[model samples]
Target: MLAFYPRFIRTFDDLPGQLSLLIHAWNGCNMRCYGCHNADELIAKPPKDHLSGAQVVERLSGYDAMFDAVLFSGGEF
Candidate 1:
């Protein structure tokens, strides 16, 4: 499976001191729904470069003081 995703999706929140992080697990989906932009690489397993749980926590930890909260989004969370 391929591992690729956008850096972040814009948020609509108007609150101050807020930051959003869009993390892609890169775990391909089983569904074959039409019009899926990521359909080409859909599979049962995630790519070898997919970040582990600990790595994810560590990645988010860096933004602890800068962001109020982090949002996890992907084909599934």
Candidate 2:
């Protein structure tokens, strides 16, 4: 129910292709698979103030034309 844009992409000078926005949906995951890089953080409780889906869309409205796709990430449970 929450998402965040964690990357700061200022330009496409050194990029290879069209850009995609990565939305970190930190809603907590319990999988805890071995070798998982985000195991510790994802297992912890998420904050109550995280932005809703609507809020995320509204906040990124101005930059609509910047990216070609929106990639929802994080959370495995």
Candidate 3:
């Protein structure tokens, strides 16, 4: 079986009341919609450093106790 990996460019909304993590899955996007911040990152394929599903779970597992929920954004599946 293949190994799992997870990568996030950065996180936001790290306030005391709301503990949320913004996860960036793939940089490769099929659509070129307007007002897109990750336009540059989108390509034919996501970078090798891109995170995987299992990796994401592991990263967020630690925050499960502190955070209410994880918000996944950037790049469409």
Per candidate, the number of residue pairs that clash is: 0, 0, 4
Between candidates 1 and 2, the one scoring higher on lDDT is 2
- Give the Cα-based TM-score of candidate 1 against the true structure: 0.49
Off by over 4 Å in 1: 1-17, 31-48
TM-score for each of the candidates: 0.49, 0.55, 0.57
lDDT of 1 by residue, 1-77 (tens): 43434343434363445665545546555455567654554343435555566666766676677665566544554
Q: What is candidate 2's lDDT per residue for 1-77, written digit by digit as tens?
A: 44543332343333447576656665555455678654554445445556767877777889878787666656552
Q: Alpha carbon lDDT of residue 73, candidate 3?
A: 60
Instruction: Give me the displacement of residue 11 in model 3, in angstroms.
Output: 5.2
TM-score of candidate 3 to 2 decimals: 0.57
Model 3 CA deviation exceeding 4 Å by range: 1-17, 41-46
Instruction: Go through the candidates in order and give the C-alpha RMSD of each one to the true structure.
Output: 5.9, 4.8, 4.5
Residue-wise C-alpha lDDT for candidate 3, range 1-77, written one tens digit per residue: 22222544334454456656666556445466687776565444446665567767767676667655566665455
lDDT score, candidate 3, position 42: 46
Top-lDDT structure, candidate number: 2
